[model samples]
Target: MKALPITVIRSIELLGLVLLITVLYVGSSIIMPVLLSFFISIMLLPVYRFFRKRKIPEIMSIILPILLLALFLAVLVWFFSSQISVLISEFDQIKKNVGMHLEKLSKWIESSFNYSATEQTKFINEQSNNILNSLGNILGGAMGSFSNFIIFFGLLPIYIFLMLFYKNLFLKFIFTWFRKEDHEKVKEGLKESEEIIKSYLLGLLIQITYMTILLGGLLLILGIKHALLIGVIFAILNLIPYIGALFGNIIGVLLTLSSSQELSSVFTVLIVIAIVQFLDNNILMPRIVGSKVKINAFAAIIGVVIGGSVAGISGMFLALPMIAVFKIIFDRTETLKHWGVLLADERPKDGENMI
Candidate 1:
C-alpha cells in the first residue's frame, strides 16, 4: 500500500468524527422521548413514595399519580388552547395596531438617543412585518404537522408505563453493574442524584409559580391588556431557562407598548421582568435547588441549548436534569472526579450555592 500523507489521514479522522456525531444526533432524536418519559417517572417517585407510605399498593399508588399527571396535562392543554383562541381572534386587532406600537418604540429610542423620529422609525420598521410573516408561516407549518406531533405524544404513555413498571429493575441494573467493593459508592451516588433532581425540580416549579403571579400582577398594574394570558405564557416559557425569560421579556414589553404606546409601561414591564429573573436566579434557585445538583451556569446553559437543539422543547426541559445525573455519576468515580468538578457550581469549597 502507498503511504498516506499525515494531513490526509487527520482529515479522514475528522470526517469520521463528524459522521459519528451525525449518527449520535439521529439516535438522540429517537431516544429523547424515552429519556423524557423516564425523567418524568423519576419526578413522580416522591408522590409514589408518599402514597406507598399511606399503605397504598405500589400499583395503586401509581394509579393516582398517573391520573394526576393526566389531569395536569389536560388542564395545561385547555389553558393554552383557550388563550391561543383568544389571541388568534384578536390577531386582526394586533396587526392593525402594529404601526402604533412601532411608532411608540421609535419615539422612545429616538428620545433616548437624541435622534429623529423618522430615523428611529426606519430602524425599527425595517421588514418587521416581513419577519413576523415569516414566523407566522413557520409556525403555521409546524401546527399543520399534527400527525408528526401525535406520534411523539402517543409514545408518552408507553414510555411512562414501562418506566413505572420497571423502575425497580432499572435501579437494580445500576447496582448490579458495580463491583461488590464499589457498591457503597454506587448507592451513595444514586442517593445524591435523587436528592439533586428532586431539589432542582421543586425549586424550578416554585420559581415558575412565582414568575406567573408576579409578572401577571405587574402587567395588570401596568395596564397591559390580556395580562394574565401573557403572564401565564411567560411563566411556562421561563421554565426553559436563560433564553426563555429573554424571549418572554421581549414579548411582554412589546405587547405592553403596543396597547398603551407608553414608554413608561415598556420600561416598567422590562424592570418587572428583570426583577423576577433576579429573584429566580438569586433567591429562588439557590434556596430551592440548593447545592443538590451542582453545576456552573455556562454548563447549565449549554446543556439546555444542546437539549433544545436535539429534541426541541421536550429536549430543552430534560437537558439539565439529564446533565445533573451524569454529573452525579461522575462525582462518584475516581477517574471522572475532575470532569464532575468542571460540571459543578463554581462556588466556595466550604459551602456552595445553587442559583
Candidate 2:
C-alpha cells in the first residue's frame, strides 16, 4: 500500500480527535457514570478477590466491597450535613457580619476613590439583581445535576457488580481485539492501567483525609468558625488539580470573612491554607500519589480543562487516569509512541533542544 501523505495523516488524526470529543460530550450522561464505575470497580478488584478467595459466593463478593464503599460515602455525607446544619443555624450572625463588612468596604471605596455611598448602594443593588438572576440559573442547573447524581449513583453499584462478575469475559474480549503477537503487550497494558487507577484513586482518598484534618484542625485551633466546613470544601475542591486549589483558597477566605468581623481571621485562614497546600503539593502528594502516571504539568492542566469542558466536574476528576491509560497504550504502539512522549514529564537531556 502506498504511504499516505503526512498532511492527510495529520488531518485524519485531527478529525478522529474531534469525533471522539463530540461522542464524549454528547454521551456524557451515559458515559460518565460508566467510566466512574469502571475506575471504582478496578480499585475494588482486590477486595472482591479477597472475598472470593475466602470461598464467598460471587454475589457476596461483589456486594461486600460495594457495601464498604457505601459506608465510606455515608460517613462523608453525614459529616458535611452536620457541618452545614451548624452553619445554617448561625445564619443571622453570618448575615450581620456580611452587612458590617459591606459597610466597611463601601466607606473605604468612598474615601479612596471618591465614590459616593448612594452611588455605591445603587451599584451594589444593580449587581445584586444580576447575581440573583445568575443564582436562579445556577439553582436550576444544580437541580438537573442533582438528578444526574442520583442516576449516577443508582447505576454505580450495578455496573460495578456486573463488571466484577464479568471480569474474565471482559478480559477475553480485550485479548481478542489484538493480534496474537500483541497479546503480551495487551496484557501488560491492562495490568499497568489497573495498578495506576487503583493507586491514583486510593492516593486521592488519603490526600483528602489528611488535608481535611490538617487544615481543619489548624483553623479550629485558631478559633475560626466553620473550620470543618471550610476544610471539607477545600479538600473536595482540591481534587481538581491546579485550578481547584485556587478556588479552594477563595472559598476558604470567603467563609472565614463571613463568619468573623476581624480581618486577622481572614489572614489566618489564608496563611494556614497556604501552608497546608504548600505541604500537600510539595511533600504529601508526591509521596502519597507518587509519580506513577508521570503526566506533565501542561498536559495535566489541558486535560483537566478539556475534561471539564466536555463532562463537567466528573470528567475533570477522571482526566488524569484516562490520560495515563492513553499514554500506556500510546507508548506500546509503534506509530503512537511520540504522542505518549508528548503527555509525559520527561525533560530533554542536557545540551539537547526540544525541537
Each candidate's TM vs. the true structure? 0.79, 0.96
Where is model 2 poorest over a 10-residue stretch in terms of lDDT?
346-355
Q: What lDDT score belongs to each candidate, Candidate 1 first?
A: 0.77, 0.93
> By summed lDDT, which 10 consecutive residues of candidate 1 come out lowest?
346-355
lDDT for each residue of candidate 2 in 245-305, tens digit (9 for 90 to 100): 9999999988888899999999999999999999998999899878887999999999999
Error of 1 at 301 (Å): 2.3
Best by TM-score: 2
Residue-wise lDDT of candidate 1 within 1-355, one digit each (tens)?
Answer: 9989968865885697478546647887568768777777777889988999999987888878877888988987898799778778888777757777766657887788889987765765777777886997888888866765787778877788678878889989988888899888888888777777777776776776777788888778877777876787788888887888878887787676555545677787778778877877788777777777666889989888877776778778877888899888777877456657778886655656532
lDDT of 1: 0.77
lDDT value, residue 232 of candidate 1: 79
Candidates' RMSD to native = 6.3, 1.6
